[model samples]
Target chain A: MNPSDDAGRSGVSRRSVLGGGAAVAVAVPLAAGGAQAAPAAEAASVEPVTVKVTVNGEPVTVRVDPRVTLLDTLREELALTGTKKGCDRGQCGACTVHVDGRRVLSCLTLAVTVDKREVTTIEGLARGDRLHPMQQAFIERDGLQCGFCTPGQVMSAVGMVQEGHARSDDEIRERMSGNICRCGCYPSIVAAISDAQKVMR
Target chain B: MRAYTFTQPRAVREAVTQAGTDTAFLAGGTTLVDLMKLDVMTPARVVDINRLPLRGIKLDRDGLHIGALERMSDVAADRNVRRDYPMIAQALQLSASAQLRNMASIGGNLLQRTRCGYFRDVSTPCNKREPGTGCAALTGINRTHAILGTSDACVATHPSDLAVALVALGTHVHLVSGRGTRTVPLDGFYALPGSTPDVENVLRPGELITGITVPRSMWAANSVYLKIRDRQSYEFALTSAAVAIEWRGRTIRSARIAAGGVGTKPWRLPAVERALTGRPATPDVFESAVRTAADGARPLPHNGFKPALLRRTLVRALTVLAESR
Candidate 1:
């Protein structure tokens, strides 16, 4: 089977459990089908580890395979699909997220390492109807086309502003180079970030 | 990725004890995890050392002590590092992406593997990956291979921008384990790709890098790192230079230089430094000194342009440093 198909098979959505809407530390039981498409013997022999992490704001305890990345965990287990997966490798920043208020590539981060740490994804950036200033600026500046890379760009832009390096266009371009825009929305993205950085400052 | 048992060690001693023959230490996970996914490195046990208390960045009488666990972005943004060692800051800023910089640690950056496609692709034969398999890049598409310090077994270039800068400034890598502690110069830390390209470094089985110490010098504050890559940002270097020079009036007092993207390891240009040691900082002197920058280069078929590019990059870096100060 193809790898993408395996990734989809791992997606046993936990949306219903998460929609409970309280910051409670809920321990969800692991499903047999939630395991990766490894050999039957290997899957049975391998043990899953328990991870206690705070996503968005709610504390979540999940039993996942040791090798599962935070990107897959966020997309498949938690059903926070806003954080796209452009390249599973670290080459693309599509899976960028804030771990302890610092931006990091979720694709390269193992879920177990984020145990007891706070995670912020693209879904967490909005508050009710009023969106984040950066998100609103992205919409006003027409910063996206296909919208595949928008989540990562917005998250990275927010992080760049927090890092205090959004001083100039060149600096912004350099700092934001991690997230690739396949649709080439860099000009509009820069404009959007420029607009948002002022308010963010 | 193959199945592995993961454990988080609370202390350095615990982390060291958990490491074994088929085990890997996970920090940042930028290099190790990427390779694990590619199947190039398969470890049965993974020891996560993120919680180890090794994050320290300070300048003392011994020089700048940078903890191995310190993230790349934090080290680059440190006020003292920016003010005293601009080359280190520039190298760190110009590396991977901002997100990667936030995740990658200083020690992990030094141990990053080469970006050679042949080395990365498991289908192809790569001596560096699997010894005795023979090198695919020796005759295949090798436009980005090393032009210096290459052997018949391998031609992949070293991939760290921060390493070139640290080597130029006389840095030492500190290591620790259950056995004891030892220090090695950054220059001698890397092993040449003579016949055994798989043995990259001199680290023992369970030795963990604790930190690095960069020697304090007058030239460090005036130093700079210049990287010429395929693109303007977020790419590996095609040809890069890290230069630090101390001047006596208009004449050069001491000079240290190292090059990247053209050598199996961070290539030090002592001949070029010797040529410029007592000369006046001028265009003619720079042009003449850089002539020896690529002294014993052995360029492959596709990477023949690297020798010339290395010389030009060095001259440009020196010119920029001379004018800035």
Candidate 2:
């Protein structure tokens, strides 16, 4: 059994869960092979952990399982699916979101833990339908191939620009390494980021 | 990923009181959550330790005190840390990714589990996950496994570049349990690959890492991390070196050296440090000192590149550090 085979046996049968190493909460269920999907913990069993999340400048209140992932909550409950889920295991950055203005992988975060904090997803990157500079640059530069890792790349680029990490190509590559473009369109990706820096400036 | 009770304690005392035989402290959710998804770890109850008021970054006489809850990105982005402690910042920056660094905590990085394939697979019997079940890596395809400090039981390398840097910085970790708070040298955190490969760290059950402290010295300002992986970014190290040395005239005042991707833990090369202590800051000296990187190395069939790569990384890291200084 190779490492990949071992990883495959660990609930990933087809794809190699590689890319973002952290921020992936892969809750596929326990090794209870025959155990029916445990019904969502009932309200009675659920702790009414009041999570006050300030999302994209708007304060919102929601009741969540202490274990509910920020990714699923934002997508399924909040109807914000712009943050796609390529590899739910945090190996892919498709679900990257911003926690307090810093990019974080939503799939790996617990909703209850981020209570009383600010959360930002790709859906919040725009203002009145005007795309963010990074998003615009990506469109103009064709940074994406299949558009799966685009949202994450865009979010990360926005973060890099805001954080002043877009000074050099090596830095851009080091910073953007978290988002994987399966199409191997890294040259365009870097170009888009460089363009975004100028556009945002 | 089986649904387990998520317990958030207001304090470490309460959290330790709540931990049990089947309980696991959930930190950063970077490593633990992924394992749970694979059914590799099943803690009936998960005690979320993030909200325990254990977050801060401070520098004192001993070293830098990074609370376990301090996000990796915060440390990397901190102006003071970047100015005074470049090695720590570089280590944190060179880890997973910006998104990951933002979510991952420094304490959690220290406690990160191995990236071995068998341990993550449920169908396979990984001695690390289920002791005595047998180590599949022995006969299995193990390209990313360790090439140093390997025993027949297990040979997994500690994966954190931050840890490798921490070891080189001579950092000590502070832990809090129900009993009291105490500090342990980073060198003692990881256990040797003995029969019980299932166990990883030296911390007792229910012990929580509260903070990591590194000594304040000129060496920290001159430290650097050089990781050689398959890809330029977002990949675990094929081999890496963290070198923090202080030079006085031509003699070395102090030298801290450690390597990743080739050890059971973030290997602190005291041999290399001893070799470099009185030597001049030159390439030949660096080469001779680093040649012992794998002195006791026992490389598997597929990992022969490790010893040589480790040497090259050592030279590269030293050059980078010397130039930065």
Candidate 3:
């Protein structure tokens, strides 16, 4: 018998067994059945959670699903698309944002959890249309190629400098290892962060 | 992620009372939120414990007392921790990324699960993820699996670099439950995967980790944490060692050693420590003593190099510690 059939015969929970290869096959039929039960599930599951957060510098209130991550809330709800989403998983630092002046992965942070905390995204790095020092340094040093990971790199660099751990080049690279630039722009990124540190100091 | 009701508990008593089989206490949400997204952990209720007054890091006359809610970055950057317990700082610095270090809590770091690919992917049959389901890492891509602690059920390595250092420092975990407060040695906090792979720790249901206390010792000042990994930064250890030695002039008075990434839990090397006591603080002595580290190791097909690597890591850590001061 197939694994799913075997799983069923063994008295395992369907959801537990559905985690395997047969998920796709089971999901289609499950979705059809779920559609009939959608209204009831939606009423129970989609209860909006209200959260008040100070994004960038402005305090704002938003009602979102409890499952909605801070990254999704920032990009979709607040229209702060500067914070990129490379890998929705916490592995990539593409969704790095400062919550209460500390860098954290936005994809892993539930929006409801950070309810009264101050959040600083990439868009918050400037003062009235003037580029932040790190952003200026990134441009001057050509710290980015393709520019997808640049926002995260710049934001993480800001956080790193604030944390005071980037005293040397090796330290800078180590501290900034979270933001991965697959375009092989690491040398330039390090250069940008180094230059930004001098100005920041 | 499945929809779950969230409650913020203002007090530790309230958090403990709210916790149950279907509930999970949220700290940094670095690991818990990630696992929930993968559907690996689907707690029906999430109790936010951040509001609880458990964030303290102080070096008292007795020892270093670290609150459970203290963030990893804050603890690593603490002046007392950096001066007296350098191994703790080094281990925290070498873990995950800077972003994660800032987000993860000291208690949450100790409780972080394995990074085994099979356990992470819900589609696979992982005994740790679902008991009675066979472990895929036993025959699959298990280069990162444990060699020191392995059973027929699981081979996943404990992923915290900080835990290895804490175990070496002889840290004590203080836990609080509705019943009362109790303490367990850090080495005894983790459970080895014997017949049941699902149960990873000895924490009772509704029990909360209040803090950890590391007793003051002269050996901690000379401690070092050496981690070998695929990359120099932002990668988990292949075989890491945390070594702390107390030296009186040229003779070693006492030694403590622990290994990570090669064990189901943080593997303490009492044999290696016993072998180093009274021996002169020399490279030859360190090299000879570390040989006993792999005595009881059960290396797997893909991770046969771990025993040798673990030994070399211990030697390197000891050498660094001996050379310092």
Candidate 4:
């Protein structure tokens, strides 16, 4: 099966159902005039923008509100929840994803701004059933504890290695400081990245 | 976050024309989007300026000309910047996280607001957030507040580490609008928080930052940026110093010093620079020169340590630069 077809198959049905329910919810209120009518009237006026993005080598087009973040769009619209949102602010690295081959915090990036860019999320890292080398190394080295920050850690590690700044352990730690593991899995994470460095090369 | 219209402008003229009091220019959306989420900044329309042809890094006979839209990570990783302007490179590298650095532009970094807790929380009384509201940071938690160029209306410190280096190296900020183009000294670009704490910069309503030109100087080659933070990485500076000095054998010909995290704006130390000129590059001279750094500092209750910290940071940066020679 094609990757884009798989993504579209999962996204189309869920969104259509949600869209139908939302339209009914808005219609019923507008049909009945009350104090609740004002908010529903305002909701109707908001223009939805169609954004075209290449996700995981798949061209995914979706209409989202301009306020929706790239992180929310990936998780909610495309049903790719591999990218977690730790802090909606840019402070945390949990929402890290590759945009045009560079790492960026998706929570702070607007979905519409990345119109036709290539976005590679955690789900995009694997090749069929085979896990990425970073993912394999993380498991081999026990690089995670709670696993909440694991996806971001793996993504950031891959980006760090690709940046070629993590030549030594100290440099690895410094460059990888954006992603936090509150479970104190620093040593293991560093070891896994160090091991993956050789294999990735 | 309030819903707003996002329009991508292809040219500088369209972007400036679209900008108004109720509109904002969005480039690399790191700071603007964060503030919009926090409800600190509410814009009816956000003009996307990323598509404008303002992204370039050039080294010419004048000096280094960096586009305002250049990413912080790209600027830091530039070979010319790393070799010739170590202070700028170090400052850019030491700012924010790697993810943020990759997304944030140089222009957005300069225009980033303070990290004051009250300013970010919309419910609180912050003069910066809503002018005429009382400043909660004045008597509340102010450990990270400013000690220089501060007034009763506001005390939040400028948070850009890059601005400190730019100001120290005598960079020129190029501004363009429908009116025309003009250049301003980066040092004087930031407005001091006097009675009007809301007006943070000298930028007009429709003006756009085109790029910055850093003049090549003998001092730029031997410059250094030292930042003192609570953590080793991915943290804002408690106090930072950017120093560039020119030495003739054993004597100092000229010096440029600027500090961050302790001033309402990027604080330039002309007095210290003057004190170092013609002076021998020695520990005693550095100590005496830095003593004048806190000449007009008005320390708050929780920030009494900042004046001392600022002086120590400058001394340390000067010591490192001197030792490198």
The candidate maximizing lDDT is 1
lDDT of 1 by residue, B251-318 (tens): 99999999998989999889998999989999999999999888889988897898889989999999
Off by over 4 Å in 3: A1-43
Chain B alone, candidate 4, TM-score of 0.99
lDDT of 2 at B112: 88
lDDT per residue as tens, model 2, A105-137: 887887777888988888688885588888888
The residue-by-residue lDDT of candidate 1 on A1-201, one tens digit each, is 854366457853344335433244334423222334556666556677888899998888887777778887776677777788888888878889999999999989988899999999988998966799999999999999988989999999999999898989988898899999999999999999999999988
Interface Cα RMSD for all candidates?
A: 2.8, 3.9, 4.9, 6.0
Lowest summed lDDT across 10 adjacent residues in model 1 chain B is found at B1-10
Give RMSD to native, each candidate.
4.7, 8.3, 10.8, 5.3
Clashing pairs in 3: none
**Would you estimate the TM-scores of all the predictions?**
0.94, 0.89, 0.91, 0.93
Residue A140 accuracy (lDDT) in model 2: 90
Of 1 and 2, the candidate ahead on DockQ is 1
**Candidate 4 clash pair list:** none
Instruction: Look at candidate 1 and tell me the lDDT of residue A175.
Output: 89
The CA lDDT at B152 in model 2 is 88
Q: Distance (Å) between predicted and true CA of A168, model 1?
A: 1.7
Candidate 1: which stretches are off by over 4 Å? A1-36
DockQ of each: 0.53, 0.33, 0.32, 0.41
The superposed Cα distance between candidate 3 and the true structure at residue B234, in angstroms, equals 0.4
- First chain TM-score for all predictions: 0.84, 0.77, 0.78, 0.79
